[model samples]
Target: MPNKRPITSEDLFKISNVGEAQISPCNGKFVFVKTTIDEDQEYRSHLHFQRFDETSSVQWTFGKVRDHSPCFSPDGKKLAFVSNRSGKSQIWVISTEGGEPQQVTQSKNGASNPVWAPCGTQLLFKTSLKLDQDESVFDQEEKKKEKKKSEPLVVNRLKYKSDGAGFHNETYQQLALINIETNEITELTSGRFSYEPSSWSPDGKSIALSANLTDDADYQIVSDLYLLNVETKELTLLTDHNGVYTNPTWSPDGKTIACFGNEREYLGATINQIYTIDIHTKKKKCITETWDVHITDAAISDMRSGHPNPGPIWSNDGKTLYFTGSENGNTSLYAIDENHEITPIFAEEGHVYGYTFDEDRKFAIIGLSDASNPGDLYKIVLGEKKKTRLTYINEAFLSEVHLSIPEPITAKASDGWEVHGWVMKPHGFEEGKKYPMILEIHGGPHAMYANSFFHELQLLAAQGYVVLYTNPRGSHGYGQKFVNACRGDYGGKDYEDLMAAVDFVLENFDYIDQDRLGVTGGSYGGFMTNWIVGHTNRFKAAVTQRSISNWTSFYGVSDIGYFFTKWEIGACFQEDPEKLWYHSPLRYVKNIETPLLILHGENDYRCPIEQAEQLYIALKHQKKDTMFVRFPESNHELSRSGPPHLRIERLNHIVNWFNEKL
Candidate 1:
């Protein structure tokens, strides 16, 4: 490791991310997606197959196109996956013995999320379709000619636009059945609502799916599980329609269904819990009601893509269920029995983003990542602690770089609340040299900063800056109370917790330069950075990306602003305009003395560009040191999934600003 160079921003192109791993029914083979950046700066992914006993993996699918969501048939003789090779994403099937792949569906909008039936003769998939649109509209060339001119978007619902997906169309996601032998397609359910298929029953006569069938879908914000009779097309509601439920898995006996969801007891801050519902009685019980950890993978990282949240996979015997849980800065696999006895399976200090159990339950193929490694697939034998590394996707690139491994640290807030986080030392650290430190914050006040590989953090550490990132109140992996503690108190105790983290690190680590401290974050973290600069000038420099400066404007502009404001801030702008203005960082911009840099996405609907414009103008009017940078054709996900060149440019801006000020 001594001769290896520090990680560079350009190294982001070299990292390969593994996800959607699935073990074949025979347990001898597994398939996963390996995503990499092409020379054109676009993402390319394909399927990879590997035998359990073999050391090298075979590239199963060939193309520069994206292929993912690999699913095996009941007999494991054929594999089904989704690919955009045909200009639009559609389901494709290939023999396990290797042959030419056959296109199964050719709908106008294309098909995805293919689930093979128990009989293996049919597959269920979802596709976007306009109301009353027929599946026969598959002539792409004809449709292209029929395309109409741009028209003004007439909006009626509150959820009209999204960050990644822009304005809403009339299309709704609908489920359909396709016979692989004859290539015959049949529409199953169609309406204004969208349906997501989960699993097929053992007898292949019924399918379990989730959808919000309520009249007011935009305002209700709750999905319920349902049973769809394959032949009759009769839908039966499973849940009480009071809470959000999804990822329904049928037991082997087909009598009970397991799902992950929770009631809106805490609104958006509610913790996900596992529940079991009897297929006949419609009786539901929360199996993980007493569990303190979140049942979903809330780990945030820029290196991962297309990783799924497959809730509560059932064992072969149906008496036990397996799932991934987030707890204490790690996402690990867990097992639970009918009596609610929990046991840790793969509880290593890393992120277990995806996993799939073989048909016999003999082993599981897990996709895991740590602080130093990007990610890879490993095979873990059931009821054992040992695991065999199956794929070395990023091993070669990892060997060429000296990545910093984060050390876990804890701090006590002013109110005696303990905050948790990690710190990464500079790449080539000398014992006596004082290094500048930068405080990095994560978005989704609800998401956790786990033990996963973050390219941005590594790049910062490589540039001779000690990177400090912490999970203040409102972060996941903690209990429900701790996560909900920051609601309506965004700048109150949460700010104290972050400041305490800096104090704790400075008191413990002597090599950090206190005067050269800098702070930066995005979304919620961006709001925190603005708040930090306005309230205190402890930091010498700050960079806020895709941030929120004014809560009043944010409440009306953001895609989720209307409801999210009341849910997270405890009040709507109509109810208390003064309170919303009080939390607005722009209102106190006059007090900021730190050199501020604002980076925003031009098309970001989550935190609109106006938020950054307001802050930049206010600071400029007051003659404060400030700079504004905007990236066009980008959204809220600019940092993680934006264009390759822009992402690097954004990183370069941050590093340059800190290098100049710190």
Candidate 2:
């Protein structure tokens, strides 16, 4: 292969996407954010609105401003959103019918996830509380004095390292109530940690939110549902126990609150189920189980879907709730009646990540995607069952690009457990020639890899390689047992599943060169790649990103380390360090023969840099084949949400390494 042109930052930024979905209170109108690149190579996003009658969609907010999280007033007269039009992100409001959006609150720190109060006289949102200015002189003097000594840099946890947005302040996101009449803002909840405000009761007496208020354990940041009395400012914890709880939506009458979250298990997998809590009794019931399916993953990329929460829409009478799930391959919308009987509202072969219902429930605004399309918006008219395209947002951009389709394939593990995988044959593949193959693994071992569109996998296929990605044990879309089976058994059966996937591909795809096989993955996928390289030299090369090499060391560094380690390994660090060491891939580092590439973000609290450093140092000490790549200003989310330039650079590096070594 010939050396390609050096990668540039502009190439990376060009691949970023802009997506937002909002609804009007009257269910008569809808709004969504449209993002694009300008002539100056700057990204811009704005709000667009469309009436239920399809009176034509029109851009609402203007200028070079990037506005998102649009919500309509109860009276359907005003719209609220977060915009940086004034040089900094602030809350603003505008009329739904027409008129300039009015700036609500101004602050150097940004405000986000705005929600209209039921009374329409006020709005509730979260804003970062700014810290005092930092004195760089003191830090410089300290560095100079310590130049001769080897001392570790100490940072304040509250004002620690941030990504493209620079260092953070001693700030935490707090719930704020803004009076639309006087533009006065009142802080409701304040603390070192942040609170995600989801919704307000229909009567505006209480605000429902999710936060990690109790149990100061460093590793467990799982949020639980809470209700704050608006008048007294009293906070009440609603749901308890080990599971993560968020996305609280108030029932029409304010008697019950609906939220989505997952329960932690002994295995690495989590059961993301939907629950309904009775405010009066504080009793909870898992509503999703009635359908025999779970709302495992929610697809909203913005805080608008209420981060870490279930973005559920209540029926007109408030007797039913509707959410999205993947029970039969593709994601679909399911409705749970008041009686708790769940049934599919709509099922399609394509993916339906989420839906926004109009006030009347007559129309549903949805975000959808297929094997070919990354994402698109649709208006599904109830009763009539008509699907209308709201915007051809990415058509013009994607039309010029060549995309590949994912072909489903089956593999059987050594234990005879059937594994599911998707293979992307090299684009423009030659019929008779054998091509190098790359096995891609997904993170969350619990997360499934379906026949959906994958940008990275497709790019590799386009570059002339057969990309094979699989969802072994612990992956979703399968039942609970298959996923939980991987618990306390890290490199065991799950590893065998991956090996079977590779063998199945080699046997079914005759054109694949067995000698030129490679593997790469991020997080859990990265963990598996590490295990594979150590256990067998089948792969000619490998790239592990933000991966864990040693379970013992990993149990101390990651954000979810304590609970996560115990859950996955079936024992806490103090109880069974030996078991953790036994499952750790780094334990067999000396046995690894394949050349390896290690990548990690400098500030990944989930899987800290030390994990990568340990592997790199071990391999280098052994004088084995290896290389390490580090992203200075990145977190565990580098692969998905890092700066455009860095993400592309990261991908290119993987491609470069595999191209040269395989």
RMSD list, candidates in order: 1.5, 5.5
lDDT of each residue in 1-662, candidate 1, tens digit only:
68999988888899888888888888788888888899998889899898888988899888779998899999999999999998889999999999988988887888889999999999999988765345342334224467688977667777878888787666688899999998777789887788999999999999999999998898888999999999999999999879999999999999999999999899899999999999999999999988899887989998864377677889988999999999999999999997999999999999999888888877888889999888888888988899899888888998889988899999999889999999999999999999999999999899999999999999999999999999999999999999999999989999999999999999999999999999999999999999999999899999999999998999899999988888888888999978888888988988999999999999999999999999999999989998999999889999888888899889999999999999
Q: Write the per-residue lDDT of candidate 2 for residues 1-662, one digit (tens) a residue.
A: 12222222233344434356667666656787766555554557788887766735698888887887777788878888989887667789998768888888764466777888888888887777743442211111122243475646555563254333444546566778889998777778765667888888888889898888765623465678889999999989898856788788988888999888776643346556788889999999987664445484422121112222237778879888888776535677777787887776667666676577777787777777766666667887765546787766556545556666778888888877888877888867778899999998888766766544456776788778898887788777776777787888888999898889888989988999999999999888889899999999889999999999988987766766766788777777899999999988899999999999999999787788898999999999999999999997788887766655567688889889998998
Q: Which candidate leads the pack in lDDT?
A: 1
* Candidate 2, position 611, lDDT: 89
Top TM-score: which candidate number?
1
The TM-score measured for candidate 2 stands at 0.88
Candidates in order, TM-scores: namely 0.98, 0.88
Per-candidate count of clashing residue pairs (backbone under 3 Å): 0, 3
| Cα-based lDDT for every prediction | 0.90, 0.75
**Residue 410's lDDT in candidate 2:** 81
Candidate 2: RMSD over Cα atoms?
A: 5.5
